[model samples]
Target: MELEYDTRYPSVDDLRERARRRIPRFAFEYLDGGCNEDVNLHRNTADIRDVELIPQYLAEHRGSDMRTKLFGHTYSAPFGIAPVGLQGLMWPKSPEILARAAFKHNVPFVLSTVSTASIETISEITEGQAWFQLYHPAEESVRDDIIRRAEAAGCPVLVILCDVPTFGYRPRDIRNGLAMPPKMSVQNILQICGKPNWAIHTLLHGQPNFETLRPYMPAGLNLKQLGAFMNKTFSGRLNEERIKPIRDMWPGKLVLKGVASEADADRAIRLGLDGIIVSNHGGRQLDAGQSAIKPLASIAESFGDQITVMMDSGLRSGPDIARTMACGAKFTFMGRAFMYGTAALGNRGGDHTIAILKLQLQQVMEQICCERTEDFPAFLVRSEITGSAGSTMSNR
Candidate 1:
């Protein structure tokens, strides 16, 4: 589909700035901030940007093609939308907006278990092409029922989250009273009032709810009850015991997200998972942990052939995606980037962000004389080699 985006907000940074102005501080911080001090958060993008690529200006070149194959499906682009919870809180119907846009762009959109939209709704939007990310409910019955719903809706992949054994200590969330059993304090109300556009849209669309889990939740529960329900309902730590049942039950591809170490990658292989997304939950779960790229490089080196090695944290632009690929990621995903888009531009956010990323990535491919997404490794600077076969010391 042809996408006409707002020319003014061309970059992800621009979208971020606009989103900050448009949404309330609580919503913006929830979408943007990482755990304590955000050191790992900043480090993720910083280190990924440090990767250098050498352009082959003299080489005979054809136009770039961004098409990529993953899990037996050829997507239009190498990157897809990472699942984000409470998406509608950021922008009304943000999950549905992204799911439809991803389908239109021929890229995958993962639906979070705690997202504002339900499984069946996103499946219908994407025509059963969207993937589902399971938060691993505390009860087996709840987990099985969710999986069954996804299966019935014809979801192609089931992504199980492995991080977040305990909630990250986000000071902003706490200060804003956004934590479980969220308190709508006066400060939050004043902040919401300042963003009239956001407030109006929220009023029009109705308040954002955890639509996927609404059936399981009680009606008109207070903020404290909501917090208690969330705490008691899901288990964040994923182990072999929890995963084995999901693997056996999920007929489609099973991917383990939040995998950071070679050990976890190897375990995923041992557990017979279809793929492992090398991520640290966008640097939100661990404040002092290594950047996603650091582990991605090692994991891709050791297990690239055995399992599909993908990554998600700290990627914001097309060049970032290219950088991750050069470091040895087979595929990449983004969460906050798309949210920033929708929050900044409302209905056009998804299409606009995807178009911009596609353009930027294609430009990188053409500039480097790389024909396909998989060939990005050949342009990586030798010093940054992650055990890939195509590391080159010379720029020539």
Candidate 2:
């Protein structure tokens, strides 16, 4: 983690800007764009911003701790990197880079089923700090094989993505022809021409193929063909029956991701799963879905003890992370933020992003007179347009 460069941009947007400049346009849009009208996507961040924290002053300034325990394992931070699909398309060997950084920081790193790197590779790099996120395939044998691979790789946590039964309707991808393997259209070729460094890296890396899927794929498939195959292969929908086998087989923690409604939470609790990530797939899956932070309070109130309620989407900075925690989120995860960091700084991205979040969270704790993770929810305040606010000393 080198902070030698001027830390002018503390926000995720700052890193995004750098990332936009560093990578090609098509790749950047994959990380930046959302489904259909993108209303839910914009709302994810805007809703978090509306939250106000009441600052407490004149408290004895002392040491602050960000360490949090989840499912018996203690992590250095209360946040982790959310799994993102086709990460190598954004930056070469992205999962590996993020996994290594998370391992070094003593935090959790999630590996998506469709990400560029294989589970075994990430497991080796992260030394088993990695958790696997599955997009359930229709084939039971294939799904079971993947589960076995994850277990063999020493992944303690298994995250089954319940949303995304169908792929999000991302208009930017359609326009850019940014499908699975990615087509070299005239426009894409022109875009890559402008990004000389990215082009050179791509040339050297041989265009970021899905290493995990190669063995399972048929012979002589191009990028577009691979994309179509993946689209056809996955079942997308996850239900009680699909989850039962996973719960039975996975000896370690079993997490259900993309959970929104109370019904889903109740079902997850009944399934005897270890935890459920309260997310809307980063507002990418359903266009009309509720903001992740909004329903969290009620969900936590309803099923907090039965299952650990974690959240992702709408989290950019440390304050946003703290805001989610205040609203009963046991843990927070950010996908695009770290991607922006890696895209902006290449190999140095994860370290810098983690550093920035740590700094921001510490400042929030200092102002709120809060020290440990458990004291966070007490500072939570519910409001209308402003959403939630942290209670200041005066309110206390």
In candidate 2, stretches whose alpha carbon ends up further than 4 angstroms from where it belongs are 1-8, 58-62, 180-182, 385-396
Which residue pairs in candidate 2 collide? 181-223
For model 1, the local distance difference test gives 0.92
Cα RMSDs of all predictions?
Answer: 1.6, 2.2
Give lDDT per model, in order. Answer: 0.92, 0.84
- Which residue segments of model 1 deviate by more than 4 Å? 1-3, 384-389, 392-396
Report the C-alpha lDDT of model 1 over 213-255, residue by residue, as the tens digit.
Answer: 9888999888899999999999888889889999999999999
128-182: candidate 2 lDDT, tens digit per residue: 7699998888888788888899899999999999888887888888888875545
- Residue 235, model 1: lDDT of 88
Specify the poorest-scoring 10-residue window by lDDT in model 2. Answer: 385-394
